[model samples]
Target: MSSHDVHDEHLPAHRSETTPATEPIADPGLPAHQWRPTDVDPAAEKRAERQVATMFGLSAVCTVLFVVSYFVFEIGEVTTTIAGLGASTVALGTTLAGALLFIGIGIIQWARKLMSDHEIVEMRHPAASSDADRAETVAAFNTGLEESGIGRRPLVRNSLLGAIGVLALPVPVVLLRDLGPLPGDTLKSTIWEPDMRVVRDVTGTPIRPADLEVGDLVNAEPAALFETDEEGEPLVEGVELQVEKAKGAVILVRIEPDDITPGPGRDDWGVDGILCYSKICTHVGCPISLYERTTHHVLCPCHQSTFDLADAAKVVFGPAARPLPQLPLAVDSEGYLVAQRDFDEPVGPSFWERDSR
Candidate 1:
């Protein structure tokens, strides 16, 4: 090796590490803190306190008015009009809304004006704690609890509790209103009568035997479901009747007469080649309308529960446990279709206590 190479190996290869230049660094501290007007001026502080208190005071008054309005306005009463809304609705809505809004404004004002406004910086240490550190934390928590003085200041605590307790009253009161009268036996019968003519649902035209071709499916309702009584009174109307008809709905289908295998007592039910069955799926009450005429099977779109219309509407496929209910069909003197009577059994999805007999 050359002498230069030998000398270079003996010398320390460059500096082992690089150190930043050690000069005294200047500290850039936080900017000067500005005091609020309320903190410096006694008059401003008093005014701000009054403003917050006024907001809270108004909120209390509105809460009282909410209670009053609950009784004052009858729910459906029609009185003076403001922009086409009833005066009671407007008053109740505004007063109740103001009650909540004013309280929120009051809390915001209190925090802005009166609550401690000092900025604090906390230095975080490692999350894992030693016994000594935990003891110190507990001591600090006790000191904070003592300083908060919540137990001694009953006015604020009591008022807060009162407001919260009063707010809970309406929840139970509204729930009690839901426990009112229920419809009994109303769901068991529809507007159908002994000789009511069967009609198409929307067009309201009477369904005649000739109107249905082979394999044709028709959605029909009892004529009484749409008729007025002799005294011009509607046989059924409103929610009670609607729910009844939904469970008693029927569908009429016309197939070849020789295709049918009637249930034990339903031989005389169909008129000519026409047969009728309930529209509701016995499994989950979905309207079963998808028909396969060649197979004589009607499929429920919901769960694919297929029923054999040719054999007493028996369950032929899918999850349904029972057959669809059959409606007896007859023709009136005018050659329009009519129901023999109300369904012999209840219609709709089977319940736990349902009796199929």
Candidate 2:
């Protein structure tokens, strides 16, 4: 008896057991194939073929409509609407969805009702293929292509081809004009000049050294966001205010004075235990400042990129290729915390022109 059989023999009669190796297992062949209506009925086959072709034709119509709608409506015109959404948005979205959805349905119906219905059986084999196996695979691929009858059905084939060709036309049509003009030198600078007060992001109240405690992390922006000029006109408003706040976003963290390891020529960058760094991640421009007070490490939520805030915000883990840029800080004559100047390096994800290590 085999080892497994011997082991089974030692078990009690009450134990659950399987058959012995000495007995042979019979093979059960596949069930008989069932024919579909489209397979045996000539009328049904023609009907299915027409259905798939009709779907493909509709897809082509939707794509053509999408292209037409692109030029039909003005972007910001408030006069027209479909259920409160812009007429342009509703038209573009519905047509594009229909274009993709109809093509997908057409392909699925064609495969199910018109393509080859033979059920294939493949035996388990070693991963490495022999020369004969490769030749047989190529022969089977050619056989499948012939069985699909794509060459015989001119209506379905031509409609599908036309739909696919028209689908790609919308890409360049929207990409060329949808996005506004280039950002030109706007990203290279911020409104944070020398002596600009660092204010709370939402409250817009200026911060002092006394306002922060050890292990405190605060989100801040430049005072120019909320302040007014001599004539009482806002310093910045609307899109300009938004752009400046996005570029000047910063995080102020207070660590133990003894824990800081400042970079060269940056010894006086902090006051007491307070230090400031950009709130943007270096990897992909995600906003950061998820702080671990014990380790003084801030994490980017998007990609989990970690930066050691105590040591010039140097990246310690994750996909970030560089450290968070440090913003120099000082106290104004009014005892409010202020920026010594704009960040020495650009603050955000690395770009082609920024090669700083």
Q: Highest TM-score, which number?
A: 2
- Summing lDDT over every window of 10 consecutive residues in candidate 2, give the lowest-scoring window: 180-189
- Candidate 1 residue-wise lDDT at 94: 79
Model 1 earns a TM-score of: 0.55
- The alpha-carbon lDDT assigned to residue 144 of candidate 2 equals 84
* Model 2 CA deviation exceeding 4 Å by range: 1-61, 64-85, 101-144, 153-159, 168-191, 213-215, 227-247, 255-259, 264-268, 284-287, 290-295, 301-304, 349-357
RMSD of 1: 9.6
Q: What is the C-alpha lDDT profile of model 1 across 116-140, one tens digit per residue?
A: 5666566888899989889988997
Model 1: colliding residue pairs? none
Residue 286 in candidate 2, Cα distance off native in Å: 4.6
What is residue 347's positional error in candidate 1, in angstroms?
4.9
